[model samples]
Target chain A: MTRPALAQLVAVLVRPAAARELSLADWDLLVRVARVASLEGRLQATIEDAGMLPDVPPAPRRHLHAARVLADRQHAMVRWEVARIHEALAPEAIPVMLLKGAAYVMAGLPSAPGRQFSDVDILVPQARIQEAEQHLFVQGWVCEGYDAYDQRYYRQWMHELPPLTHMRRKSVLDVHHTILPPTARLHPDPALLWKAAVPLDGFPGMYVPGPADMVLHSATHLFHDGELENGLRDLADLDALLRHFAADDPHFWEHLTARSFEMDLARPLYYALRYGNELLQIPVPDSAFRALAVARPASPLRGLMDGLFRRGLKPHHWSCDGRLSGAARWLLYVRSHYLRMPLHLLAPHLMRKAIKDHRKAKREKSEP
Target chain B: MIAHEDLKARLRDAGLAIQVGPFVVRLRSQLDRIERSVALFYDRQLLPVDGAPFADFHVTLARSSGLRTVWRPQARFFLDGRSPFRPLPLAHAYPLFEWGLNWCIAQHAHDYLMVHAAVLERDGRALVMPGEPGSGKSTLTAALALSGWRLLSDEFALLSLETGKLVALPRPVSLKNAAIDLIRERHPRAIIGPASHDTSKGTVAHLKPPDSSIDRMHQQAGPAWLVFPRFSAGGSDRLQPLDRAEALLKLVGSSFNYSVVGGAGFEAAANLIEQSECLTLEYADLDASLGLLNAVAGGPA
Candidate 1:
């Protein structure tokens, strides 16, 4: 079947349309015009009342309704799950704070209502991750599989533990070893998370990451990899954070930058702020941003480094389509490896991982 | 001075400039006709709107005719929803929309190999089982996720392709008929949603993803084995290997839209099915089968 670009157009436009009010005829025309964009000829209107101006608003009511409905559902799920997590982890339990979508939900933005959460995110001490895993396992948490090779990469080589899944529940937990990948040379310590943790009322043992840390996590998570897919949502979160917490302290940027430097995530923090300001119209004072800017990569070399960094955040397919060369790929791979492990141990560690992945693949094949 | 119209009023007041595709739809003077046309395209009754401003964020709801009822993005879900969202949500009403949206925006970004499978992980590894309804996928998924393995999803298992993180969206594990009784008999503490009856499909009930799964919901998993499970009443207990092409096609078919993701989707699907050992399990015995899965999942660790 010849692929339908119409579907893509629809996917892109439908959401926009829902954002505003369009009479049936307007929507119909909008779709038609989009389809005919390539046509060299002038377009013709088919409606009888073409001359009459459509009273439809710029955006549709349905779009907002849909966004709100999804957002509300997301909030309820986050609220319910966060509360449940607090209850289950108990009083002596590790402090867990909501990250990304969960944080946005608590921040009380209308965007929170539409923000979709595929899985709930929380931060726990790297040491307690195993304990957390076991605790969750006994309580019906099932680990989704990774072979010995894959397992080693996550446990010993990478920053986080392999994601833990539940058999009965449709949720997955991303138990992190470090907030930033080990290779990024950034470690937003879990202890920092605990120190700044804010308690949810009535949930004696439960806590969310403090405001500063929460905002940092949001920036880091959104900007760590390129914030392509959820860019708008990230912008919304930054907007929310700026409006909510910044109001209390005009020096929120100081706390934010200090924490980023403390964690060595200033580069990612810079990128997030830059893109947020550029795309979402978030306002970061030039002076504040200047202090945190990642040192410029060498000219000519900078373009390569930028692409490499973006690729690291992108899907493998993106790298391929975007034309990441083998040499560049290898360099980027090396960077990722370094980010994942201590600088001293990265080489041999990655070599071991490559061998292990091969062995694991062979083992899986022999099984069935 | 003229008062600004409310959002609803604008729609009532605005003239239509109709266009569905290349052809412009004839604008109707009456509001009744516009509502009917919008409804006709929207299979499910619900329409979520942002009410002005962005205008592009609107989504129409649609449900799968077969197996479980999932509220999918009207355009994308039908093509992909059936294979990916099995045992579907108990009903397309609210929960489905809520859970489905999260699966799309947040979890899918990482190439986490989003599977229409339920996950149960123990030790550190997880077993991802993707399948269609009546395949006994959920019953087995529910049993394993609740038993010991972390419940990745009774509905959708989010596996990251990059970090190989299997993110869990443990909402409600939906069960039909005997499976509901089976789970109740097995785990008395299980919380279940109300059973919806005489649905165009069948009598359906939702088992809440175990409380702990909900509590520790952000668990990321690396996929070790990809199993397409089928629960037959008297079938032999065997986990057979599925070929890569077959496995990929089956997975893509089972996906909400293997096509939508295009090449990246293709690569993600290929990478996952390629790396993991593939299995098609058919069995009548739940307990014995779960034992097999546990052994398979827990073997090396």
Candidate 2:
């Protein structure tokens, strides 16, 4: 069974009044969920509303306030970085399309409020990505050290260039040509995403992905990537985006399913629909249910994926983790690497990482 | 609050849950040495169980035993079931916990403008000493805490955003190297913990905080004085006024979250410097330094 506390916390997040009252024990578990999921700052509005009633206490309120402050600071830093990136990319005329947290904040989406932004992401056209990188270099953004092997790997197989950091500010910028890596089975055309980009009014030369693409990108990043460290937070983002877009567009669900098919992202969309509805109770339209029925895995594979994702998406709390969770995470990790690279490259990379990690642990344990 | 004997028993069993200034620490250990330190140091703060399983940082301290036990047996600290750093010798267990507490604060408490400084209150005024390690901030704070001044904190100076004041977080003062002997000789009756030599920072011991400071822990002080202290042997005692802008920059540089707090940090810092008198003090003798401090506090020397 899903942890009862996890279920209650998710329910309360979706519909705040669902929590009639909570004991100190419940608040304790919620604190861990909020912290590990990085939702403390994002849940400020709900906390403020909840605090007005008798359900909240001073200790929990303090924790919520702390998170809200961090979110506010993060939002400020993101805005500052956007201005600098726009200055750098403006000269190249590279129609910057912000992705993820940067996009949510720029577009003034509900998901942006109190969101923790770690780094800024931008999308440029594939043809001019090199020129864009050169322009950023002149503006003091230097790419991280990539050896001959890594340089070849990224140039030939990756969708985005290696991440770059500013010399003075030390802020990170991830420039992308497409949402998914080129090595992936799904080959999404960048032109379609660019053509549908919505420009922000005040911020000239900057745009965010169109409504359907935004949700699809979130789904692909969460499910396809190698790391599930922030899986729960990413799921929360998908849930919020789906709900927001549905409210804005009457045909959002239909359009999203069609977009998924055209972009060759049906697998991630199916997973998103199934879990978003099951976990966060996002309103799934008839189109989504019908699409999931056709696109989802068959019975045995479906049962296995169900087991993996259900455990994988919850925050890493001991109370919620079962014996199977560790193995599930490991399997998912290997699966991501397999999906990320061909078997030849994948075998060596995993072996190297294992040996390096083992040596580091042993060295640390033996230190004075 | 739980009785001291009960608290020790709980530590031997499940763990001892204690609240230390805005954070709940759940500590578990089987070592008798760690238990004695717990009884001597954290006796006042352990909370009675209220049937809640809440803790911000869960850590375990265990003494290593084996062939290596004869020569420098060590104490290992674990947080969230992971060890971030190497073990210290067993005699360093008490300081290990102190440093661990600071680590947890630095990692999680991003809500406040945390400055690496010593803060103490006298005459309803706060004295903030922002300095680097081995800069006499801790030693000066210990002397002040023992001499009738209410100690706010010897390590972290938490600047609150909502109230726009300094929150008090008093703990045992850590004395290092020559300062350890200085405090022991000067105070005479000082409760100095057993010293552990050859630490990364040299020999270190802790001075137990005066009981009155712990009793008045809830009191937050308004900003009044900003003192940047540096101790030099055979040096003259001097406290010179510093420019407001310069003080703001130094405070920002010393802060843990000044950049993270964005505009709020800049504004709060400017407000603090504007209301307080900023000075830089250099001294060799503790008596001379305390006299200058009293003069600044409007007391006859």
Candidate 3:
């Protein structure tokens, strides 16, 4: 009864071989679990195996059907976006790289099939990011940034431009120069990422990170994320990427570990490897497992993180969210902020954000 | 299955699970008014096993926590255990629940192409009236439901993407402002709920479907007529045939999930247009309009 439904979802997904044997106690709880973990769409994609959903009854089947429809819609939408983004930036000739879900789709990886993308993320060379933004604006992808502070916040400190959305289509596009904010302690070299990028087959100007770098980016994005709203999904994506790249290259793990160190991202990678194996039951090479030990947070921090992450990463729902998970999420939220920027810059940013939220809330309340 | 008094008691005590359209919805609330309102509006609904699956949406209407409850006294809506929006006044809890259910369907239900329209059937053929606010869509639908037409839905016309048929989702028709009084006056026997004033959509109330419509809730209808009802105070009744291309364009605009449902939406919209003779209706006279709609549906005119 105390078993976390998130673990059960991941178990079914990553270890489908054992899924046929597992008896479901509450299909109702599992639906919430899948939604909270952002695995509803992924579950339908995962349940394509011949015997995957044989035990699931009708109610749960209905929920899964909705999820499948959503995934299909997202998949089609993502493809259309890539083509649109390509048309906008083609004249600039700036080597634009598709990131995350778009990259997964472009590469046709296992993770691509049912991945739901909120926004199209593209990496342009740092020097040309502004030029790329103007090109996009001309092509109708304009920023809806309402405030001076928000515009300044992104332009001054953040890694990406203010999110630009198509006027007609309304699909959001996030233009990024690097993975992390400039104000963060660890700013991965834009040149290094571009150097490792590989062009997509049919998309002429579009590219995706080389296999190892893609895994590293996924790990970095997940671990460093302020909110792990889709924590389980990201971990699942990493699991898929590791399994996928491992097929063609024996040294995929070796390169991933080395690249994490090279980019000063060993900390995130350590968490990714530990939780990826723990929650998802993904196979981690013994040598790679031992290699990450040096990179794990030292002693007291490691103990604190273990408790925080175990609760925080799981779905924040009645099925799994312990009373302590709320506190854990807050602590982790603060921890993410701490990692996002140095203390000098963090205070003002937090204050500005709080004020903006308060004013916005007031405006909404006053509306008829 | 729990009925009126028992369902209200259960909803007050624990929660109530009921089949709504193609999905099961479980709603929890401690408000006494919620119990009374639900009993009245959803009296005909079929209750499922308590705390069971097949619930596409789980919602709760509880008193807002903290000082706001002490001051203004509000009821907050929680969906899938998360409160997506802020609280509404306690008096408007019933209308809030109706709006919340509509939100649940509009947001999550993607298996069908959900059009923001009123749907009713007569003679095995469905009539779709896709309209914006102040278009007399719900009022016209309310009038028809009381007359002889089998009410499918007063909110959504759920077009099955696979079969191109309209699924019946019979629920109370939401009547706002003067229309509530109009419906009450016209249909004297209509099961109208109490009015909720000063909602986001102005004063609103729900009018329950007739017993006959409730009885045929499971019945499905084939697409036949699309009427875009436009209400005006002095406008004479008129029904002009709309071009297929323009009709499809208007339907796509009225659809809640046309963009998200993608190719399925396209196919369903195309199929609906092909099957139905579309029209733009401008009317002030109920009898005249009803006559026109009946004639178009090939029902007894």
Per TM-score, what order, best first? 3, 2, 1
Residue A209 CA error for candidate 1 (Å)? 2.3
Worst 10 residues of 1 chain B by lDDT: B20-29
TM per prediction? 0.45, 0.93, 0.94
- Lowest summed-lDDT stretch of 10 residues in model 2 chain B? B47-56
Better of 1 and 2 by TM-score: 2
lDDT of 3 by residue, A212-251 (tens): 7898889888788566778888888998889999998988
Residue clash pairs of candidate 2: none
TM-score of 3: 0.94
Q: Flag the better candidate by TM-score, 1 or 3.
A: 3
lDDT of 2 by residue, A1-368 (tens): 22677776787777777655766667766766767777777666565555543456656666776677778777877888898888988876888999999999878887787677688889998898999999899999998766676666677778888888999988899998988787786788889998899997777888999999998898888777655777767777887788889988888888899888898888888888787778777778876779656677799998999999988877777766889999988888878888888888778867866786798789976865
The value of fnat for model 2 is: 0.46
In the order shown, what is each candidate's alpha-carbon RMSD?
Answer: 21.7, 2.9, 2.4
The order by descending DockQ is 2, 3, 1
The interface RMSD for candidate 2 is 2.5
Model 3 per-residue lDDT tens digits across residues B80-102: 77888878899999888888888
Q: Model-by-model lDDT, in order?
A: 0.55, 0.81, 0.83
Give lDDT for model 3: 0.83
